[model samples]
Each structure stands twice: as C-alpha cells, then as structure tokens.
Target: MFFTPFFKMLLHKKYILYLRVFTSLVINRTFIPMTRRFLWLLTCCIVLLSACDKRMVTADNPPETNNPTTGAPPISDKKVQAGVQGIVTDANNDPLAGARVVCGDQNTITDQYGAFRFQEVNMTEAAAVVTVQKAGYFNGIRTFRVTAPGRDQFVQVQLLPKTTAGTFDATAGGVVAASNAQFIFVPNQVLDAANKPYKGQATLSYAFINPESNDFADIMPGDLRAVNDKNELVALQSFGMMALELQGATGEKLHPDGTNSVTFRMVIPATLRKTAPAVIPLWHFNESTGLWEQEGSAEKMGDSYVGTVKHFSFWNCDAQFPMVNFKAVFKDDKNNPLAYTAIQLTRNNNSSSYGYTDEAGEVSGLVPANEQVTISVKDQCGKIIFSKNAGPWSTDANAGTFNVSIDPDARLALSGKVTTCDGAAVTKGLVNIQVNGVHYETAIQNGNYATSILRCATGAATVVLNPIDETADKMSTSTFQLAPGNYTRDLQACDVIQVSTISLLLEGQTTTFTSPADSVLFTSYRSDTSTVSIYSLSAAQKTPGGLIRINIQLSGIQTGPSVSRYFTVAMNDGTYFSESLNITITRTGIAGEYLEGTFSGNVQKIPGNTTAPVSGSFKVRIE
Candidate 1:
C-alpha cells in the first residue's frame, strides 16, 4: 500500500486540515502538491491502511514484498494522545478529595492528595467539566478544554467552603433591651461566609421619641463596638470608622441564629423626684418570634424610686424633692480628647428659652418627668452646626451622668484643590511636589471639575493640575494628608490648574525640604467620617441550608434623648438590598441595677414617629 503527498502536510500540523491533490487517471500519473520529503508521513499512513484496504493508496516507497496489491491508501490510521492533570482545593485552601475527573467518557476520582488522572484518552475533539463535591462544603465545578495530549495532571480548582447555620438569642442575659440610650451602630454587616458561621462587626444605636409627635430629637455621644470576641472601644459618629478598635472576636454568622454573642452600650436613666411622673419602656430583639419586644418596663422591673436623693442637677428645684447634681461629658468621634464646644440645648425644637452650656460644656437643667432632650453644638459661625437627639428616657431613682455628643453636619473636612493637571486625578498624580494615595472620589461633576473626596481612608493624596482653559499647560500642584484631629489651614485661591509643568513624586518615597522657603503651604486635609449601617432583618439572606437566623441590635451614644429610626444596606453592585426597619430606643439604666418596672403607655397601634434610620453600613472603597 502507498500514500499520496497531499495527506502528509495536514496531519503534521496541529490542525486537521485537508489538501486537494490532482491526478491524471488516463496517464496513470498523480500530481501531488508536496515534495517527497513531506510525503514521508503519508507513506506510513498508507502502510497501516493497507492492512484494511489494499487498493485505497500507493506510497513512494513500496510496502514489504509480501503484500503489495494496493493503490493510494486512506488517512486517519491511528489515535492522538495527551495527558490531563489538576489539583483540587477548598476556598480556604484545604485539600479536597473524591473529586470526579472525566475526559471523553474516561473518568477517575481524586486520590488523598487531591490529584487525579485519566489515561489513554482521545482529547482532540472536545472539552470537559471537572466537578468536586463534599457533603458539608459547597460544590466546586471547573471546565477544561482537552486541547492536547499530555502526561501532566496538576491543575487547581478551588471550591468555596460551606457555611453552617447558627442562632442569636437574647435570653442569655447578653442581648440587652434598649433603655434611654440612642444607637449609633457600626457599618460593617459582611458575614464571613468562608467559615462555618457568618461573623460581622456592627455598631449599636439607641434613640428617643417626642411624646407629642414621637419623632427623633436626640442621641448618645458615643457608641460601643465589638470587633473580635474581646477588645472593645467607644467610637464617635461621623468619625473615621477605619481605626475603630474592637473588644471581642465579633464572631461571625450567616444568619441571626448563627451568632453566639454580641455587644452593645446601654445607658443609666436620670434620677426621678418623688413628685415626678413618667414612664420608660425597654426594648429587646425577640429572636424566637422574629420581632422586637420589651424586656420589661422600668416600673415593672422595680427600677422606679419615689424617694428624694441629692439630685445631679446643680440648681435648686421648686419642689421639695432633692436636687440631684449631674454632669455631662463631651468627646469627639475616634475616642480622642476633645474640648466640649459650646452648644444650645433646644427644648422641643424651640431655641429661644433653652439652656446653654456652662464653662465645662455642661448644661444644667431640671426635668420633672421622663424627658427626651437635644444639645445642639455650635461652630465658629454661631450657628447650630451639629445637633443630635436621643431616643427616649424616663427618670429612675438615681442620678449620675448623662452624655451629649455633637455630631457635625458633614463629617468630612476637605482642603484639597478641585482638580488636577490630567483629565482628572489619576493614580499617583502630583500637586506641587507630593504624591498622595486617594481613597474617596465624588461623581464626575461638570466637564471641568469634580466633587471633593468624601470619607476617604487615611493616606496622602495628590491631584494633577491640568489647565482647563489651555488644556496643554500645567499648573502648580498641592498635596497633603489629614490627621484625626481638627485641621485649620488657609485655603489657596487659584484659577484653572495647568498640567504642563507639574510633577508629583509617586514612588511612595519621602522628601526633605532642605529649605522651608521652597515648600508650598497648601491647606488640605482628608478626614472622612465613617457610617455605621443598620439593616432590616426582614429579608436578610438565610443560610444556604436554612439553619441560621440573624438578629442585630443597634447601639450607640446619644445626648439627653436618642434619634430613633430604621436603616438599609446593599453591596456596591448587589441588585437586592434592604428595606426600612423599626428601631426602639430607651434611656439607659445603671449596670447591675435591677428595677421593678411598670407599663405606662401612650401605646398607640402605630408608633407616632417614623424617620429614615441612620445609614449604619460602613463602606471602604478607593476612589
């Protein structure tokens, strides 16, 4: 048997190409397109095909003398070969076994080493999907194209770990009912799905309602945070949530039921006089019933006392009841030492007759019954720049201290220029001589300018200063980083920024201004306030196996009263998010103090106040 020259070229290359060869039958001559050296491969195909059909082909070299009755032989005489190898792992890098590997109907299971092999298989025609499965872990599926024959069988496929369902119950004496404290919850709600239980860090929020309208009027000064299972720190609202220190493991969970422990900050109620009349309600999350219910009223818990003790209030009262002396401490977010700036204590939104802060930032006032109060902090402009309201509080039998925090209107302090030299600020742009890593950016404004960077992380920032008018000219640049404390810098007044001549050092190095005269005094800062997200428990995603439920407590510091409300959260690109949730804030009671509380109500079928809950979810993105 023999082969023609045309069939040899197509078989050697990686592709299964066909060649058209011409032949003259009458003259008994075939004109092949290729040379004899290339026909060597077709020569072999003819030899093999001759065993099946002798007349199909003829080759340049004659077959063994014993068998020679053949024309040109056929193609496709043998099989193509390749090897398949890969590794299997879990999402956390744990080795996986029993994974099924298959190619062309040939299959094998992964050994203890998570390695598999499928030998002697044809791979030229198609691809296959290798699937790994375990009873408690999420299944892993990967596709591989059987492109060529090989001996290596080591590819890697990682399966996501499965999460076990857990529960959160308030009955263990750990989950507390909201007293008078307003909640200022932490913003992170991401449950680590890689572990058995989903764990997250959140802030607690408490609020107070107006007796007449039941709307938000005040809140606490600081909120407590539980990070891991141990270290705890009180955080200031609108402060950088970035450096928030935690007290505990903040163990994870996929749902409410999966949580084993949680942390919150509660408040002690103000002291009540013998003649005062008021009712305080305490609220807690009912994990079993999927609702929020009162732990017990202040009266029912025996927390109320009608006897007269030295009042914390500094002033003398008209009634025979003792005047208790009380003090209020003020601190900024980040839990740092700060001067309690002057503030106005507004009564029912009317500022004409309210009390003002004393020398120590304390407001001395008297309340006959339970009260929800507001302390509005003033800025240099003499305007009420930041004001927070507490949820609700009823005076009890004792007096100690009440905290009033002034939350700034905008937690952001910006001093950077509006634009850079390039089209916009890019990675490592330069202003003057510094390079800053920017974390926050506003939406693209007009074609000329951009919004200031808001809630940016801790870092230096540099913006390019391209001239807007000339487009080709470069303007002088500015760069700076904002520290945690109050920043006071003079603003630089300038026209359009030119990009033609500015170069900022972006290598993340340091610069020493040998002479102060050469340094530019640009007043810019980047202190951003972080958000603590509060989410609705109604539609939170359940554990995949339907085993755990999640219950969250909103906790935080407040003024005399808290701003009670609901909140929502969603990922940057997640299609589904949260709806409005209901929050109930009550005054705090002294720790280890038990009260025989009573149920006194202005209980209506509908709570009178419904305001949008404070945005509590913290977000970290580089802008």
Candidate 2:
C-alpha cells in the first residue's frame, strides 16, 4: 500500500518525473535493487504513475477538481443563496399567466403578466434550474449559471403547446406519428398510476423540437447539459429532440412498463444531417433535477435515428462534447450594464444555447472547448441586437465586456408618478408596463416609477400600464400610443373612485365619515353574496380604545341594485345588529375595475334591545 505522504509527493510534476527516471533505470537493470521488497514497491509506484498519466492535463483539458472515479464536481461546503426572476410565454410570444414555476424546493405561480420572482433561493451548484408547467402546454425549463450570492438572475421560458399526435387502445398498441417524430407502443405494456396494466385508450401528446428553429433556445428544456454514463458533465449537440406524454382517457398519466420498452425515432434536420453521427447517446430530461441523464443509445439509419426508451418524457439524440467554463459581460453604448438581456452562443454545428444576463450584466456557462462560436445579443422580441464571432479558446476564459449600441428607434424610456384619485401619493404599489406584447414591471416607490426598455423596431408602439395599490388593494389600467423616446406622465388611479363618504345619524347627532382616512371596503364573493365594510379609528385612541366598524352583508345581488339582509355595527358603546338593511349596488365592475354601492339601515343596541337609527351612503371601490 502506498503511504499518504508518498502518494502526495508523487502528485508533483518534478517528483513524478524523478519517479519515471528511477523506474526507467530499474527496468534497464542499470540500478541494482537493494531488496526484493524494493522491487515490488517500485512496481506498485510505476502502476499508480501510469494510471495518473492516463488523464492528460493539457491546455484544452485542464485539471479538474473532481473525483477521480466519478467525473462529478466536488461537493461544496458553502451554502449559496440567489435571487431569480423570470417570465413564461407561449409560442405566439404571449404571456402565459397562472403557470406554475418551480426552482429547487421553492415554487410560485406567474402573475397576470406572466412574471414570477424569488427574492432569495438556496443554490447547490453554480447553476439554477427553473421549470414551468401550465395546462394544455408542454413543460418549459431553463438552466442558467450564477456568479455569487444575493445576485439576481433572470431567465425567459417559452412553452410549447401539447398537440395530440394520435390515440390507440392499450390492449392493441399502435404507432403515433407527429411531424418528424414517431412513437411505437407495445400492447399490454402500458401501466397506469397503480402499476397495473391499463386496458383503456391512451392518448399521446407530443412535440418535435427542431434544432434549426428560431425559438429553439427558448423552448428547449435545460441548457443542453447532461451527465453521461461515466458520471461526466458534458455539453450536447442535438440533431433533434422529441417530448412526449401518455395519458389515459381520464387524464391520468400513463407510461410503458419497465419490462417492455417503447421505440422512438427522430429525423435529423436537413442542416445537421451531414454532421449527424452514426451512433449517438440518448438522453432523457429529469424534470426534478432539470438535467439530462444518458440512458440508451441511438443509431443513425438513413435519415432518422431510432432508439428504445423504457419511459416517456423528453428524449434527445445528441453528440456529447467536452466543455470549459465561459463567462462574459454586456453593456450599452453609455457603459451601463444591460441587465436581463437575452444572449445566445451558437456552435459550429448549429446547435445553440441561450441565457440571460444577471443584474450585473454577466452570464456564465459551460461551452464546447477549443471550438469557434458565434455570440449574439437579442432583444425580448427575439431580434438580434448584436452578433460577433468569438473563440477557439482552450481553457476556462472570460470573453471580457462587450459594448453594443442601441438603436434610437427601438429604445423606450418611461418615468411616471402614481397617485390615488385624491392626488395623494401611492407609497406601496407596482407599475406593470406592456409594450408590443412584452411585459416589464417596476416597483412604485414613494409614488414614483421609472423603467427603460430595449426592443425591436416598432414605428408606433402601444403601451399599457397596470398600476396596483397594495395598501388599498386596488388596481387600475391605462393605455396610450407613443414613439420611442423618453417620456414622463403622472397617473391618477380614477378607475376606482377614491372619494367615499358616509353619514350616520344616532341620538339626534349626525356624524360624517370620509374615506382615504377611514377605511371603506367592498368585496363581491359571488354573484349572489357581497359585503361592504366601513372601519373608523380615532387618531388619539390606541388599540381597540376608539374603534367603530359596520359590516353589511348583501345577498341576491348582481351588477345592478339589490337589498341586504344582514347588517352589524360594532363600536365603543355597544354592538348592534339589524336584519332589515337596504343596499343598492349601483354598479359592479369586472376584474381590475371598481364596485360602487350605498347602504342605509336601522340597528338595535342588541338583538332585542333599544333601537337606534343608522343610515350611511358610500361610493367606494372594491378591494
């Protein structure tokens, strides 16, 4: 056995060279061994040295800090936390709202603008994987590298619509074909959730992803990174890919039994047919990890590659290539970091990977080593803003900072102030702006908002602004047309009338209450039930000292007028309840709109106590 100190000494280049010379002398019999034990030790050292020399550490393939047996990266002891922001869109570039997005153990749903954000997320590797799922669409995924903790990384995902390829009876399996992809199922092999053979009909939802497509980078799952059978991380050059899902008649997931396999075939794109390899590895995407794992192999036969898979998800026929870490930063002409911009790197084989710059305008990933590549920056509309040919780099490299000029006609700068109908500043809110189908949102701080957007050319653009007030739980929308240039506007949230007043007469004394100070809320739960609440607090009182609240519950109300059956008044004096209350909902608005109504009633101090007159009128917006 080799001692630890001796093994460490042999790791040095000089020591290794000395050992090689000593071994040569021993083999040539020029140096006589003192003992048989010495000869055996030399033999062991020679074997170990030969094994070390097998891993050539050249300029192209630098020494890796990885396990010798498994090519996996060393496990880090430091915990890393990062911030992530992203958007999910469909094939038409339309924002997909309500999509479920998952990153690590944290998950969130996209807002109406198709945007989601995670303030702080734990990251185990240098990269983060985000997955998105929506009804009627295939899963969308993105894997991007991060530089450090507390930095925000952005990614854009586009989901493909799941198209029905064909259907077949599980008992009588058949083939399903879509575009240039095909799936062959075996009879009595399909299993449902319960691990039992499914005898009913099975519907296949499939999508064939062409590497030559313009949106390939946006719609493709992961970053084309995979773990091979040897546990080595490598980049993939795809000839083509196919995503498939099998579902039972009741929309339950179904898959082929492990005992039998399903054959899948994908036709190589015309552009990549010449470079397609005779035999390539087959990789299936692991949605949970957002990484591809090699499972089988496919052999190129004529124009198509055929392989068999035990299950169904996303399968690719890709040629694996060794990679080196690469990084680059982008800036505008004025030397400002271009945050959240789209960047693409295309290999000589036409296979490309895309990523977005972080808040610092930096992007890092693994790229094929010692190969010429073309790097380009694209706008949100998928238009290339800048492109250049770079590298044949050997080892890990930083391409340095790139500066690009933005076309004046494609630049938009907007600044605005948000206010309530009373002209008071909105302290806590968000301003969501949509221009030419792309959404950009900024927080409203101190009632002011500002953002600059870069996009493709549009002669005249229509801009829509949706401002939300969180304090009052109100939202309003406005739209206008403008040309690319810097503009400022002060917006008033008038969609929900802000001025609401209520007058109450009790014991021959009339008290007036106004909103914007007192709280007036209108909530419509369903078509039949609604609620109007008015809460008032005295400035000099603390806690529950001087508080008054009135709750009115209305039933059988629609968009028009209706009467309420329940009303309650809670104050410092006592609690009063009333059964007969008249509430007229003059107008009921839809989403992002307002609700206006008025109420009047008489309440008793208690259910069967002295009566008091209570009448109030309110025209307030629903929160």
Residue 433 miss distance in model 1 (angstroms) = 18
lDDT of 2 by residue, 96-157 (tens): 77677788645655655566766556665555788898889998988767766777788889
lDDT string for model 1 (39-86, tens) is 332332332233223221123322223111133211122334444444
Model 2 earns a TM-score of 0.61
> Which regions of candidate 1 deviate over 4 angstroms?
1-279, 285-296, 300-375, 378-479, 482-623
* Global Cα RMSD, each model: 39.1, 19.0
